[model samples]
Target: MTIIRRSLGWCAGGLALALAATLGGTSITTAAPPEADPPAMEPTSATSTPGENYVALQFGVFMHYGLATYVKKRPWDYDPHEVSPLTFAPPAEMDTDQWMQAAASSGAKYVIFTAKHHDGFALWPSDYTDYDVASSSAPDRDIVQEVVDSAREFGLKPVLYYSWLDFYKDGGSDDEGNYHFVASPEYVQFAKNQITELLTEYGDIAGLWLDTAPGKFDSGRLQEIKDHIAAVSPTTAFVPNTHLTEKRGGTRLAPADVLVHEAELEGDLPCDATRPHEQSFLAVQPNSAGWGWWSFASRDTTVTTAQDVMVELMRANSIGGAAAVNASPGPDGKLGLGNVNLLAEVGALRTSPTAYVTIDDMVPPCGGTLTYSGQQTDSDWIHTRGTPTGGGKWFFGTRTHSNTVGATATLTFSGPDITVLFEANPGHGIAEISVDGGPPVAVNTYSATRRQSQPLFERHNLGPGPHTLTVEVTGRKDDASANTFVSLEGFRINASANPTIVPVANVE
Candidate 1:
């Protein structure tokens, strides 16, 4: 049997967490619940806007390949003085076709490769920079061209991830240890030169995923970069993963056609309907490999579970959000078999229908009380060692009121299971949870790893009919962590399933 797949993004007001999938050897389309009203967006000249096409593309792959892959050093930890251009080389048999073919098989609509990471290693030879593939050990290899051409062959869009902060050259005006300020006119010109090359040399591109920390550049500077891209590729969607560390009152200076919230906002799209948001996070292999954002050096045990990817995609679509998952390629310039297998599993899950219910406090029929002394922000809630995930709009404890002991979100629902979705970081505190007014149970939600939309707490096999789960902050911190902060994003209730969740297809 084939299930009618409807775009749940347009369905608003009904905040029911719905899950329906065709079972018994049939095809299904995964679906999730609604959380907020779609935002009013700026219309495009084209009938099918770039934002709409992005939303339709439910999943895409974010691949990393750079100096870090060769040296096996974390992107931020590598010492430029010690590195040599001769050291960077992929295996002789490195094949871009393999990557694109796998992406096609995994049901990905696009492939966004790291054209240049913070390490300042360019995949494509750039006329402005000698620190590129042409100058490296693989002098003749054009990884970017290979990836783009291969993606076209496999019927996938090619996008590039460009880092604004360049560690290779120092910005004369503001010279910091690791920070590169685009505020410097010289640096701005340098960026423009490089960007012009990327936009003009490359054929029609899907988009450019720009990554930069907030305060790195002002609104005017950001607009200049956008203007440069517009002059070259008018229709290419411009997505900036900026404003990661900006506070609530601050404006998202460099707002683009789309926003990428990496490991920050998980459950739903934090931005309203005006601008589309792409939900992204690192797919770490093992629970111990740490956050996979900049650790291309550590490839082992960094794979994300296929189950986690499935739920993440469902949650993204539930709130009119697209999903961009990061999976680092090995040092040999090839994806590992384990990562390939996980992608296949996720691809298969996409074919199967998944109906899930999600409840955000901002939405209707999901009324709840949020009591806390800390500030409430709908963005960048998860902070680890001074760096944040750049996507979260939830209530969290502050430094002044570090003790969130009494903060609570009491949710009422009728279901057999309840899963709490929230961000957990090194400074996070434990929560005291109670069901049906029973004795409170202490659940330690603290994780050294910084992540968003985590299903930290779940209760199953309940007695049905109108249940209340009260999650209260204990105002206590783990001895290892520095502060006693607590955070809450949203929740999901596994209520009655009108249509059962059955696997119709298996991904081999």
Candidate 2:
């Protein structure tokens, strides 16, 4: 996300109220009749474009935690050259798990973590530069690794944000003390080395968010880096910050997998039918005194409520776009209480009866039961329990998976609609999903990239009664897949006709 020094008044009140009126305390409304036939399931391909995969993640959190958090300076006035590595003192109580919990509570499917900002301070210990977390006060902590582990444990995809302009290495004032941007050949090689380390060292990165590369890197250089990234991690998306580039009088670079619109309200930017697009904005607006993305000491109250976030989310979904709300952690590496509560409230709103209700594998409603059959002793269904404290209320923190052929897991529940959620990765296989003993639809849950809590099958307008949704392992996989494993996260159901919807005005 870019840091633009502009003030825009928050005017989400009317939109929030309208959204609530449309959804609150109303029976589930569909464009067609309640008895409309469910659509056919489309098969997934292993070679699907990265843009499609990225767009599947409808929401994510943008974390700006780094040296800028300690300085507490506005974006235009901050100078990274004056900040010392010693100032980067994160307490031992700094828990990435807590951060993931908050993100899970926000109903985000992915997390875009700032791996390296404009200050050239890397969260991971890169051999190319000494100005990183390894040289800071927390020398032993690998912040990137911690974030990746925590994000996976909470069933959220991890994406990295890297800045191209480095004040410590290739940026700063000239001999006359005038600000300048430089992209030296040696610096470019150093960046390439660091990027290789990031893509290779990490297990599976969803994408690489390249910031501040508009006027600095030319097409040739960008192409070189893009080709290199493809060689190492083929599935990782190469995304340039188009929002900042276009705003700062730079052309949008080619070969970009996704387009970014910074600080734009929902529906303001047109949806890109050819590629995926995303909008990133601050979760809490700055007060009268300006503050950067990582600075929040001046604001004690939350300006962006859960209703505002929900409206933005629903609008983005309507336009086939994704929303990444920026939330800053304080100098102590802890999220503000207001931000946590705001996220949790949004999660609760999404799972309300009027909204799509998420039912975890172990915790189902309407007397639902999950039964397994055709299990072998050597290769049987394995139930993995999630950490009780890691995932918030939205996540059940439990999953079931198996690689055995002919193994089936069925969910019997009383609901009008249901959607099956699963995990997709290189090791996953094809499965047959059928509703009420209907014709089975084959779904290939194989992807070069890894994503969790993905919707594999969905059905609506089943009336209201006891129904069965079954998934059977087919012992099949794409050519690029490693194995034939199938995993289940949970299911989402619309159970009741009477909906108790909370008004967005009340939340405000």
Per-candidate total of colliding backbone pairs: 23, 0
Local accuracy of candidate 2 as per-residue lDDT tens digits, 1-508: 1111111111233321111113366533223112212233232346776665775687888888876666665433444455556567888988888888999997888899989887677888766665677667777888899999999999888889987767666533233322235566666667767777787788888888877555545667777767666666777777667564556676656667677777652224453334577767777654622253564453455677775665455444433456787766776677777667777877876665233322221122222456777322223677655432333221234556888898888776544667777778778999999999999999988978776667778888885446777889999999999999988766665422211121111000
In candidate 1, residue 437 scores what lDDT? 94
lDDT of candidate 1?
0.59
Considering summed lDDT, which 10 consecutive residues are worst modelled in model 1?
498-507
Winning model by lDDT: 2
To one decimal, what is the Cα RMSD in angstroms of model 2 from the true structure? Answer: 21.8
Candidate 2 backbone collisions, by pair? none
User: All predictions: root-mean-square deviation over Cα?
Assistant: 20.7, 21.8
Q: After superposition, how far is residue 396 of candidate 1 from its true place, in Å?
A: 31
